[model samples]
Target: MQTMLTTLILGATIAAAAPLTARSLVSDAAGQTYDYIVVGCGVSGLVVSSRLSENEDVTVLCLEAGALDHYEDDILVPYYIGLQPDGFYEWGIYTVPQTQLDGESRHIPMGKGVGGGSLINGMVWNRGNQESFNAWNDVGNSGWGWNALLPYFEKSETYTPKNYSGAEVQPELQNPSVHGTSGPVQVSYPNYYWPQTNNWFEALHELGIPTSAEPNEGLSAGGYFLPLDIDPINQTRSDARRSYYDPIIARTNFNVQDNSQVTRVLFDTSDNLTATGVEFATGASAPRQTVYARREVILAAGAIHSPQLLELSGIGQSSILEPLGITVLQNLPGVGNNLQDHGMIHLNYNYTSPVLADVNDFAINATFNDESAAEYYGSKTGPWTAKPSCAVAFPSLEQVTESASSMLAAASSAAYNLPSTYDDEPTLQAGYERQMASVLSELANENIPAFENLNNNAGGLDLALMRPLSRGTTHITSTDPFTTPSVDPRWLVHSFDYDVMILAMQVNQRILNTDAIKYLGPSYEYIPQDATAEELGQILLSGIGTEYHYSCTTAMLPLDLGGVVNEVLMVYGTNNLRVVDTGIFPMVPGSHLQAVAYGVAEKAADIIKAAQ
Candidate 1:
């Protein structure tokens, strides 16, 4: 008995003497062992780590390049969304001069701090449309339909309704069962607004649009309401760190290292890709060191960096990596393909009344009266809890194009006094087709100028294509993990993408014309009232801005189609390496991306656990 006891004690002492690198708040490879190593402390990483560490034996290490964040004054204030850019927390990635947009580069604000983009974003919380998820299932991403992901959405959320008063003023949250009763994230709606924002909703209804109680309920058709992405108790932005990380910091098995940037994924020589460990830098003054992952390595570096990391680790396009001296492990051509983002545009309105002036103040909030919207939110009411977009309108491009073509044919028949058999007459039909194309293009362009002419203070509707068919590629310029790879999203690369944006702009124009919103948008300002459709098209092409919702860098398609991961989110060639970030999104959702990102991560955690 004495011998056995001594042996056990000696073994523990040796383990104790071993490096505590995993637990080391500041690791210099002192010692540590973990069942799973998750890279990036962003929303996905935080959720994955928290869920993976639930098992007592499965020790999880979460490595973050940034540190803990405080909801600072400017960040907490609703109107201060723009303050984060050029600030410390944003990575501030800019586009490589867009050819279509006068060779001008645009700023793409990416969150570099602890909570990831959630810390710096506009705090809009709309779960993309159900059709989007259904399409995913249809596209071979089985089990990703709206029905399958509903539970996960609830599991990660704590619904906070808007704080509006009066019976007609508030929105109703229809189904309580759809919302998770207990979740880490505190979702709330603010209690205040500029007072006149509801007029915008009224305008939508007058225009024949319906008011949606919960936009997150899988339908994002059209409505006016504040979005929910805040903590009602404190009136602060509800970031992922606050939701998932802060609550689990006390767990002994879960370790987190901030300010540690992972540079590479270490692998053995067998050519068998098992993520052995990671090399990271502590700080400017600290030396880079390696930290081992005993079981598996998960990359949650987001869309931009996930593919970059895969390429750095020899799991991406060989032609690009090999030229730069990167040893290719898996030549996945789809490392960065099918990139998509929302296209944004502003139509400012110079209010005739003093209505909007009150909103300029940070303390001022939007109000919502519906019991459900307010109740689900922490009593903060009004439009203040809503996302910047009070309404989302989904229009089908396929339908619009067909209708436009038919209209052009009809118009030609009437103008030329042609016979009804125009469809049978090839020459006449061809002429009608050409005229129709020209006229549609002109009409599409004409919508932009109408928006510019309305309201002054820059109140233009942002037109984000629910889904863009244009696909671009993401490739690494080098094998170096620390360096950012050459990313060519090829925005507006295809004509269909151009048409999608044009259609979205036209849709917004129609919304403005609707009696429900006419007062909110008064008059178009920027474009000339007499501007032709061709002229409007030029303006849209030149003036449009990005919505900052980038995805599809490391797409999830079948292995044969150059997908980086299989259906289970595993890299095609590796057994233990997985990716759970925005990089895995097969396509961009039709609404705000934050909630959907959380939902995806929630499901990913379960998959990871089951595999273990």
Candidate 2:
């Protein structure tokens, strides 16, 4: 019966296909000069452009490498997250082979279209721990701590209470005061949750991890139902395009160039470091053109591409550009030096008894059968409205391991002797020292969650190292902007990181052994149940992957500490050039990047407005 309903509604909906409005092309742009020219229409680009274009006198032009969204069912539906990667909307980039992970290279999935990663990422909306932001302020970046950034976080989202037909919404699960009600992005919980989630939460409770009243209130060191960027009214994905750009695209002063790739920032002269405009190409084999930025040229191309653009524009480390025969415009060594990402390991388990429902059945792998589709199309409810995983737990070292103090001591010792490359330059040395101190502090404090556990409904658990000490680099190997940069995340190079991951895995085993979880009947385990920590370490090293939260490539710090941008997000040497993306993060926060990206762009808009 369910299958029949879903199929009929899907067929009817497909037959009534609506025409998508074509966005303004670059050729249609009337003027050559604009008050602000924003590159990359991702989360940051859209927010910055939307807010800047509010002033009717100022013109804001946004250039996106990918075309406008088709609003395809796969992209709009909340459950079809994992399917969007490597599709037409993806950038199709991959990381270089990671030597620590046994020479394995993982795909670096980034959204290519106007919405950027917000269009394709798993819609988990996490604000991360408060201490993570405080660490930024501690490192010379004032006005960036938790208290300073809370307003921006609240300003970006319009929080809606969870309401579904069959499932009872838990009032204690959410705190309304910390969320916004009039923001652009819509955030809410699903109406329906898998029955197995109850058992999972029970297991967490049995293990002494309390349920947080409001994790977004800056303290997320407990179990919680993760909020998603989905609209409760329409039951669709609330991406950057839908929230920020689509509403303002019709403004006369706001213009967008789709399917356009920016090659480099055009400088006034080879000797001078002034950014006048940018050179770009539209579509494949199109003629290159230059457009002037009357006031500023903002790079919101994201962490990977932002740094890549800087290098191609001759503003990166001299050693990298000089070797490529590109003239050194500004020798900023920090452009791509501090690349960091959340390394994750998935642990799969098999159930002995038939489970109530798996995410594959209704979420990511739903066949769109008649019943489910009918329910969704008719009432905007059911499993189609939810993502694969909704429940997440943030566990600190003390909660997961018995030797938290010993581990902290080891990390403190390791901090003093970081890789020699960190000390090769005074700037790099200072940055490393600050970052190491922060890492050690988090490791010692039981209040801070060192790792995250995502309860994937398919009986698989995703364990991620939230605050990793391992740092890597992303640099251009050639002068051509078309060539992909060499990205080495250097996963698990530090011994302390390996220790923490092994301990996290042990915590997973403990959760599995709980009566509430064990009743589900564990028939299989990815790693043997009796495996020792050493064996688990080996298994983790071979299978570790990224949480896709790439950040901190071009950090905001004091210039003496290898900072590429100031607190205002302007590039260190260039006056009219600024970056608005995760690349400006001083370090990777413990949460997903999308939430922070939106907040950063919101704050950036105010900064630019104040300057004007």
Candidate 3:
């Protein structure tokens, strides 16, 4: 029932209790100093420590290994975001081996502590696809196009939308001048949505697909009920610690250490990485300390701890820090290479009359906007802000050009440049290790489930093979900045991320046998229409996963392509470091990568405050 209302709003017998508040580092218990340190309060370290503490003399620390959230229910519901996988704010990261499927091992769940992965995601806000930032300004990433990041996604948004149904405006496909009405992140649209899935919007206007009232504008292929960063006047889950830390937690020059952790980054003595300081350690404590920042360090520890804290402070690659002895200070080799992620395939169905069930009692999460779902209850809006996949279908890869996208983007960019040796290595040429012993040699491959019928029936088609040219690699076996390395998001290991996860599970088994969702009430389960295409390619090489949206591990290209932050995100060899997170993207944007990582940390805090 929405997993027992998310195990009764995460009191599931104190789900491993403890966190009541002890993450103090709010500064000066004798250790005060900072112009910025920001390690991992997630969502690129709390929006670059709330925009570099708006320079009230600039002092910001923010470490966070994970705690001090309190707003539980596995992160404020929204269909229990797949029941908070590995709970306790997930860091259960799993990846590594996979010649392709049979080698299995791939759970990859990221977002440990503070607002990282926007507090364990699934809030689904998408603002991507302005041709993925005009293909990152067509590869080079200048001012990141899409009209230079559409006013930083309307200055990190604050929309609202909950007048309870009645206001169904199309105004040319939902364009309220493309959104953003006050900012500080509120976004809206969900109050409950179910009306027998609004007959798939008249089967998506009888499959012509044009019904936008603003699906975050910038063309989202087709299929739309979009908008859901959440808040719709208190319906919760507006993450980034409630859209950028509760509208600036009383600001006094922001400190925020919480459960601490930082570990390395200390330098000085003409090694030149100045303003020295940082060594944390609190949660599960054992007496560890240090905290100095006087000027700048910003890493936003994401996309796998920002390239394992820039190869544990020596700054990356001397063939990966001379055999882990360490000390290689910036050879860069793309500190953790071009990781990239977005590989789905979860086509579950089995509706007879619960039309894709909406369990969770207390009368569906406390009156999911009452008035008996009044077009969405008492004037808020309708179909309760419909999320569960509320219309989304971005096709193209010439509908899986044989087995999928130029046979697995030449074998996952040669398993991501054969481990950053880099000279254009990317050429794994889709054998998907061996295409899983040729899953039924080619059981009627069927062009994207005959162009999205998504296993025909009562709505349920999740075919999302966005940008998966198969690239993956986030190295660092050891140097121990805090050690978690070896992130290998080599998902679908390649073969166009295993033919775009078996062409989005063969277009959710051709929309369960379409005719506009086969007389509404479709039926397919997990994935078994009597198996074989070698058992749906070993249940999609082994259930294709990770949409935490990782990204090019600190990439910000140009240094002969193995870039590690340059176009003003600094880092190439340090001098004040800086990274801001989704680890400097450099590519991966089909959408929903947290409003483009808050418009690339709000244009990297205006190029680090116009270079100080």
Candidate 4:
């Protein structure tokens, strides 16, 4: 960790940024007014703020509760993946006990520092699916369709084609014409890919899944190779800080303060609710400081904390706020009502025969790690550079489930429209009515996917439910800003969600029977042979996990439909304030969200600039 930090520090020293001491930070934070004050210096925060600062006349200030990550090995190295240590870099919080999973609570590790989730995520660069963004337009967000959002997606990434030119295997990838040549985030394929990927792709084909679709065009309902957010030149993680913030840190108009947690969004309550600035503090006991925003105050604190900030400032449900002795400035119940997450379950398989150059070799044999490290340092080629699973297939419901007609019939039925376990609030129910219709349309369409089957290649397959019907809530538990909010994803609460999980396991069994997969001699480690649907449902609910892609906490829809913000991303009933994060995403777009985050921030930057 120390060695990696030293190298990053040296790189920063060599960059064009002015001396760190010369930059305006907490010392210069108090009593200042900027055109834009962005809360949370995460992926979207840094992106939109930096882009706004491009005009020399505009001033942008970014505040982050956590300090900058020193670029430790666990963060920079792809081998470390999701195993970054707890505390400093992650907001490692646990959700409230899920009622359907026998009251079992789950852990959610969200990025906490300057670069945000882009700093700590698995770096899988996926552009979601075409229907996912088009659904946004259906939910009253005009001009948010695929054709409209595609340019921003391209504008956020600089793609390096993986169509190789050597004796090595060349994996099919996104077309160069569909991507940006000069974007802030660098995305490219790793030097090493699992040799068994082609075999797995063949197995998926044998199961009637196609592998020819280009994923980055928002049309990834089939198998395709995914790129990582790594610099093609250096082989290190390319996050928002490095890509968007570092290069523009020297801009005199832009300044970011670390360790400054905004406690509340300050507003003038005389006749009309209007954002003035925010009240923040360096620590819970530290003296509070107030900074004003001349133009607008934007929330980019992600799905978990963004709504918490809104409620802390009195913008959430009055029933929730009034009980906690907090005055309600706006009774917007939708501030934290539409919380959603991509639910996932993993099935581990054991290889009867050894798979050479496997990702698990490092753990199975100590000497193998040394050799991998040597290879990585020598030529930037090794298993250490590969993600746990880069080859994934998104199969539609008809392709994975046997009783597709009955399931679709049930989905279209009134019984599945408003399940008892889902929210009982009329507005939330109405909002779900719109969202459920969109999901059902996608499930019925053979071109859209119901789940993502990601072969870890070593021994596991991650089955992630792409569009879950279950909607939950994330609300402030107390008036205090330091208190952790209540996050309840309500996994498997809906009948459709349960059916998808159970059916996906059966699809796993079918995958093992394929000729290409049978060649690997794989055997399930967790699943019992010939288990009943009820028993299998129990196992799935017991071990269900979440993709780090938590979103839709504060949705963007019509105000009558319990949406927190408007089509323009501005919070309803408030002036000169907006939300620009995953919370504003009407639904979890496809499964992966990092690439979509880049696009959302890029588009939001333009929206905010145009309003200016």
Candidate 5:
């Protein structure tokens, strides 16, 4: 009995010493070579690595620049959504001063740890409108349409129905067939809804926008309760670490090195455009080291960093790389072009009702209460178990405005009638023409939502321009990988975006005027109720910010259309290298990016496996 006890103790010690955390330092894996080296342990990185490591023969290594989450309560609790992106687990990136947004720059928070943006996001799980994905197929990317990608969306999540007895469940909130029952990520509605959400739903119905059956099924243009990526049983935030990484971390073939940043991808000295390995560092003072990739190098460094890495590796335009004294490896002009993000403006209102619950009351109030923490830790149910419930509405151009045709005509003319800058590159012109054609058709058919309204239930309404005609770019000013890139989203540059935002504000006013919402005793706190269109437009200019849905810096269109990667997600000028993140998206889908990012990673895994 004593011998057995000693053996168990020694076994525990051995297990503890085994590098189970997947957070290895650079010194621990200096000379290692992996079958696949994945840079960035974000959603795409985790999903792709987890999938690729399923085959026991293949070794996958993931390098992340941030440390393990350590189960931070702010990240684990769903109600702490507002507090998660505190620069602890975030990159805390800031964009360049926008020329259109009153010459002001905005803070862009991106996830830095194993889970990436999923750890720092609002946890909203939206799969986007089907036509948006079909638009990718229309732009010469075959097999990327909604029908082809729907299965991948289903493959990444396990949906749970909200089962609390006291809560009301709506049939329109979910569709079981469209959601996966067995998957890594957990997605479901909150156990309880804020009292004001029902009023908002009724208000939308009264405003003539019917509730959607299931937003994830793709026809998401209507009012509905936004689904969250939370585990119903545990009542915890279901981020990429909890979903994709935790389950497979025990595999010997999979290794994740945290607090290790990949500086650049290494290539062969030969004439062949072949990627051989990657260079990384432990921290600012640590010496850089090389790690070879036997098969391929997958870059999931996200929209902003992916392009920065490419440029640092001499794969961007000659004009940008030559000035830095970096040899141009590929001269791909699209490496950092076509940046996009959803422009959002918040409208605040004063709730006159004394009995209604304030948004702060749902989470940690002015002071932390031990009893609330006890309630959450003991039963896994309470205010801490859910984020503030909200109602989302996707309204088309025609539904929101009577001047849809004329507005679209004006937008088309402004978009297609480009300046001499576009004339310099036929590829950029072709891509713009294709995007404009699709945007015009969408405006005419009302197939895609032009504006999205999110009712925060706490007298705050968020209006976002779902599809903007404006575009921007991100470029590396220097070769230093640690330096933040110049990110200019150029938001609201075109008058068309201004027109859509103005109409969306009007729609919000109409919703606020509805009998259901008006009964709640709400009054405008920001903009005046009688503000004219011009006055509202001025207010919007100062008020607009990002929805944090930045995408498409390294797009996947045809090479002739300013594409950095091909349909297979491989870089246009390189072999054995691929980008499997939001950067590969040819255009910004009209939804929150987390779910689409997971789907993209899943599909990328299949594509990579098939090629193998």
Candidate 6:
């Protein structure tokens, strides 16, 4: 019973795998002078390079530390989304022992290859709530509100509606005006869904949470079926390299170097402090080489590396640099401060018996996995074409907690404070004051989501902290560029963060008892049932992870507000140097950051183009 949609998608395998012309070796790119040099060829760098190269006279160069992307099934097939691709696609970064998590270090998964996180992330395509983006504007960044950023969000993705589906698996679309019809990134609905998806949505509805038909319309406060970045036609990942680079990479003006790590940005010896070029090396032992940037050097090296690079180049806090015996070029204390991430706690269940109509068999029986693989290879319409969880929702504090009014009241007042480090720095404290106001306001408003929940249809859920009050820092412990940076996310340090997490866990427990989803015969696998708040808090400390939504390390705000970059994304006291990555975010928005990353990069390209 193959449908016509499957036939069309099967015909479109490897649609754009043509050879690219970007320089593959550092030797080829070294000593080369380009109009613009973009560091770290991830999501933001690729888009900036491609958009700038549109002008035939302007030359753009992209430098990536990892090797070029390999389109293997492990990297692209949606079925394998649960297992992270380590060593090749990710940086393999981990945090220092968290004091609040009982001295246990956590892995910080970041992208390494060309497409960056777009290649390794679960392809959940959704946008931030309107209130969150509006907070960005309210905090002094002009032209960055939801209204201003919507065009870029629409301009980045070309939506393709689901052509064929069973009624249960189909999703509702937002208005055509909110989506782009001819953008580069291919965004579409998966051809399949989980077994108990209907029951899951029904359960949320029964609890008074609505189903969001258009989660991308600046309003995503309820349950919605998330889309994937997979190209429906090719039945494979449509990552940044494929969507933004490969098609135009063969252009003579656009050149890229893989397997090259930028050690530092080279600035002129003059008082203006203009960036002249960058020093890069293929490996730690290899000879470092210089590549000149005639106009500008853009740092799109993501949240972790961007701050590391800035500090390595002597543009960070004087206190942090002077201790490491490095001269400070700028005294910006906010270079590696204001770090934020969405901490998640997972609750899984084991079924009492086998259900033939579900995907649970694929996890236990090896033979079932083989059968599913065979079917996926034969015709692209099997369980392998979908992520482990596509049903996601954003719930307000009122939806997840019984004490929303009291919690919001405490958060809004001076009842609690961030970690002590935030108070020591006056600039950081002022900036956090604004962020605290925005997040607390969102927590009180029912239209804004306070947390995110992902349902795997196996009676399991991942509750993520959307508006965390805890703040942390990421800094370089050594002067050696090859050494790993010190990353401290400070998870659950603030009392309210744990309070909300414990409440969210209780809500997940309640969801399992709902009449709509109770028929699954669910039994707890990891989370405790009928446990007191103290017991739940201890378990959360033992096994908490994040959604990998890292941002705000090199935040964008006013100079006096502990900001590393300004409204134009230009670093303070520097000329011709900009950061156009998620690192520039003032706070982690209340959604998966992939869609917003695309929108931010698109808008940044326009801003950079206009500046010239």
lDDT scores in order: 0.62, 0.81, 0.61, 0.80, 0.80, 0.81
Ranking by TM-score: 6, 2, 4, 5, 1, 3
Per-residue lDDT of candidate 6, residues 1-612 (tens digit): 224443343333443443455544334889899999999998999988999999998999999998886565556677767665357588888898987787888988888888898888888888878889888888889989999999999899998867334434355555678888888999986666656787788888878877776777867587877777878765677788788887886688888889899999999959667999999999999999999998999999999999999999999977789899987988888988888999987777655546534556566765656656666666666676765567877888776667898987766654444555455678988888888888888778877888788887776687899899888888999988899999888877777788888888877877877887777777876655687888888889987877888899889889778899999999999989999999999988989998899999999999899988
What tens digits encode model 5's per-residue C-alpha lDDT throughout 152-217? 998998887664333233634467878888889998766556667778888877877767757778
**In candidate 6, which residue ranges exceed 4 Å CA deviation?**
1-26, 163-170, 413-423
Q: Compare the candidates by lDDT and give the number of the best one.
A: 6
RMSD of each: 13.0, 2.9, 19.4, 3.3, 6.4, 3.6
User: TM-score for each prediction?
Assistant: 0.80, 0.94, 0.36, 0.94, 0.92, 0.94
Model 1 score (lDDT): 0.62
lDDT of 2 at 426: 80
Identify the superior model by lDDT, candidate 1 or candidate 6.
6
Candidate 3 residue lDDT tens string, 89-135: 77676777765555756777777777877776777675755655655
Compared to the true structure, candidate 2 yields what TM-score? 0.94
After TM-score superposition, the amount by which residue 277's alpha carbon in candidate 6 deviates from its true location, in angstroms, is 0.4
Q: What TM-score would candidate 3 get against the native?
A: 0.36
Q: What lDDT tens digits, residue by residue, belong to model 4 across residues 167-286?
A: 122454446677888999999878776777766788888888777536777664767677889877566788998888877878988989998999999998884788999999988889
Top candidate when judged by TM-score against the true structure: 6
lDDT of 6 at 405: 88
Clashes of each: 67, 11, 51, 0, 0, 0
Q: After superposition, how far is residue 235 of candidate 5 from its true place, in Å?
A: 0.9
Q: Estimate the lDDT of model 4.
A: 0.80
Q: Write down the TM-score for model 6.
A: 0.94
Candidate 6: worst-modelled 10 consecutive residues by lDDT: 1-10
